[model samples]
Target: MESAAAQVGCLRRTSLSVSDVEGRHREMIVGDRSTWSFRVHYHSGDEIVHMLAGRAMLRIGQSARRVEAGETVVVPAGVVHRFEALDQLGWGFVSEFVAPGAEGPGPAKTESSLIAGVRAMLEDRYSLRTDVAQIADACAMSKGYLSRRFRQESGISLHDFHMLIALHNAKSMLKGGSSIVEAALDAGFYDQAHLTREFVRTYGFTPGVFRAAWQSAPRLPSLTHH
Candidate 1:
């Protein structure tokens, strides 16, 4: 897949990129105590999170659980959950959405209605596996039409868009201190190797080096509410 920087339709963010994963709809969140933390939200699929460093609390269902570094937490789909850092030291983790039995079609051709619908579908059920044919079916269009319109309108193929989303989320997770493997899974990539390839392709830097630089840099401004 082409890197986000190489794609004309790719959306750009700060070095610590964060965005919705297109196909599998997974999202990687990087939260710090000094800056900001994650907000309460629920996904259509299961959410798996692994803490990389520091301390925090996860509100799942009706109970609150303490989550420390090196710990992993899983929340079933549709369960309301929120995360907060425990101290000024802040915390970092990687999260991914997974739906074992959910069903959905892929996205559509490149017009406003088709693209909007495709975007909504991706956002709603990104954790589930899908294909271009399925998405075109959902859009009531042919795969060829979907491909042409999408490429013409977005300046990138549908598949590339999905990869872009995954890379963006992975970068955010890496910045948040997640290991290469953790970020890979969280961002819907195949594995660490896959993430490395995408990372280097998207940002022209390896994940390991990016993490090192981020760890040594000044802390990000806290976004947590008072």
Candidate 2:
């Protein structure tokens, strides 16, 4: 189990893998792409991507690494996953498995007051930038306390929640054929590059790559945000 990217070494074209996926229960899916990437989304169960050719940057959550021909990237159940083709053409055999009791979007979360306020700011007024200190001061608490409590209650940091909201809306706009600049500005990003940077950081692909992929692929799953 070496680093997949390290093993890839470079984004050069390779022979497509013709090996068959071993299971029958999971539906076999075959596909290829160039200058494209899957939308940032998660499944109810684990997903296995067995690379057939070329290389890709596979992002699970915020970290990404490369997977080349003959490599396999397995995304844990319920984890956000995406990948960008890094070579002329990358294809793969994909099997997504829905595990038992994976129904719904997990258990309900009881929102604490701190989490509620932050959620309101991030989800309700996502277009405006809200300072962490301002939230802290309003609650008569230190920023440190606010952030820690927010994370504990929400299972995510305040900054990430805000970023997710922006990214989510930007994605919606992009899928609707909005230009990158329009999506960025409307989603509260300073510019297209800002959205691209955050998108790559979170989704492992640039906005252009995502748009290209979205045009060809049918609707994919996304987070069930509040």
Clashes of each: 15, 0
Q: Please provide, for model 1 over 1-226, each residue's C-alpha lDDT reduced to its tens digit, 9 standing for 90 to 100.
A: 3344433221222123223333222334443323225434444456677787888888653567889889998876544456777868877666654322334222222236755676666644434254789899998899999989876655456776566556656656765688878878877877777876666544434676556555554432331100
- The regions of model 1 sitting more than 4 angstroms off are 1-113, 123-130, 223-226
Q: Candidate 2: which stretches are off by over 4 Å?
A: 1-113, 126-128, 137-140, 154-156, 217-226
Cα deviation of 101 in candidate 1 (Å)? 36
| Alpha-carbon TM-score of each model against the true structure | 0.46, 0.50
Highest lDDT, which number? 2
Task: Give the clashing pairs for model 2.
Answer: none
What is candidate 2's lDDT per residue for 1-226, written digit by digit as tens? Answer: 1234522421231211212123112222445444556555544345677777778888754567988888887766445456787866554444434322314222223335666566566666646476889778878889999888766655456777677668867866775678889999999998877887777566444566545444543332431211
The worst-scoring run of ten residues by lDDT in candidate 2 lies at 11-20
